[model samples]
Target: MRKIIFLSLILIGLGVLLSFRPDRKPLSFPSSRVLPASKKDLQYKTHSVKQSVVHTLLIPASSRFLVTPTLSPELSSLESFVQKHQAIAAINGGFFDPENRKSTSYVMLQGVWVADPKDNKRLMNNLKLRPYLKKILNRTEFRRYRCGQTVRYDITLHSEPSPTGCQLLDALGGGPRVLPELTSVQEGFVDFAKGKVIRDPLGSSQPNARSAIGITSDGSLLVVMVAQKPEAPSNSGLSLPALADFMKTQGVEKAMNLDGGSSSCFYYKGKTVYGKINQQGNQVRRELFSVLVIR
Candidate 1:
């Protein structure tokens, strides 16, 4: 009888401990829907992981991709871009300065350099940023190459040359490759020394809304957005390392993190989901300077 009582107490204690554990409960996604396209050529899914609702969209290699600019007088929202371009799907892309409305990330469209960091005087003239200008200018980017009839996608540094016979078509720059390796420090997302972070522009260790693009081994394109859980806004979202791990598990061969936080958003089939959530558990929406769209 005593043994039975002790076992019951132990079980109760264990249950209590688990109840207070982070990410112990799985949340259901009522907004998630599976859209059909070419059987499995295009897919979208919302997965509940820890404190985030991860949204993923996969586009087959046969589809065409474009790095679209706002093109208007100012930055535009993902929804506007989707509606204007009649895109099948869209994800926020690249970093930019909101104050001056200038892009800090490189963007190429149809073999034309649409956005260049050199044009952003605020970034280029900042004395504080001078030391890291080289890394900032050569951040990782998603590139599309056309070699005759064969088209391929790659995640490489901005300075990387296109494959021998291939013509560079479209490119969108983002920071710090996530898969294969985390280039947070080398890409200037963070400054680390002696195992301690001295400067972190993206809060590399904290949970925050994040967007990333990846290329699977089969050449399929993946656009992922990690949204903060509404029920646990402060404790939600994934860090850089966690994002990289998640992308790897999703079969990503190469990946790069895009401009995230309030700038993170995903749109498909007229439905849109923003990533960042405020302390009040409300989603924050912001205009984007560039986007990767499938039209």
Candidate 2:
């Protein structure tokens, strides 16, 4: 009888301990691998594209990351967003509507659905209208879905006819995903799988300030941006083709362009890292509703 009573007490104690455990598990990062190239290969160059300055950051594969969304319905500047979340680094996320302050793409923050698929229909329609995008769009959909659990971080790239936001959310297991566009890589790379790099319908002549996220072959995450002087020519930034080429050189196996133009912004270690020039001839730090951050 004594043994039976002791066993019951032990089981009750175990239950109490389990009930008190935290809901979220601690994060575990992947092992680091040596980069194929030197740091100089990843370094940003000023005047690399005539008056524009390109800035790049290589995040180690083992770093903890998150896609933070604005708590309020209104948009927030990079500074405000970083300060509010106490983030170590950040960059503007997917497109958003300026008037209604609604996200232009699907977004999930901390397991909560912040924007719906309807908001992104306009972008999809615009792509459908583009002649060059027709073939690629039909063959490949451009979508970035990043999901994280306490033990691992998974980033999935989907082509056209991608899954619904709810389906993606369910797959994420209640993680965050900031869908800007689909995979930039469609085909023709030895290291990358086939159907990765989509042929650029828009020629490589035009350039503008741009922001992109890429995953290197070694699995490191890269947040790359090009900053241009307000007075620079309209074609002063790297075109889509050039951007893709650059990412490939930096060892990116998969990549996606985030919002650019005046919406480009990057912050690191409590400081504004890089961005495009605004109409006021100042570095653009436009308010954003979604941001990929490191805490």
Best by TM-score: 1
Question: Local distance difference test, per candidate?
Answer: 0.86, 0.56
TM-scores, all candidates, are 0.84, 0.59
lDDT string for model 1 (1-295, tens) is 9999999999999988988798777655755354335734577899887789999988877655443433332898888888888888888988999999999999888899988999999999999999999889999998888889887889999998888999998888998888889988888458769998889998888899999999888888888999998888888999999999899889999999999999999988878999999989899999888888876
Off by over 4 Å in 1: 1-40, 62-73
Compared with the true structure, what per-residue lDDT tens digits does model 2 show for residues 144-190?
Answer: 34434332233453232323332233111111112223333331111
lDDT of 1: 0.86
Number of the predicted model whose lDDT against the real structure is largest: 1
Ten residues in sequence with the least summed lDDT for candidate 1? 64-73
lDDT of 2: 0.56
Q: Which ten residues in a row are the worst by lDDT in model 2?
A: 170-179
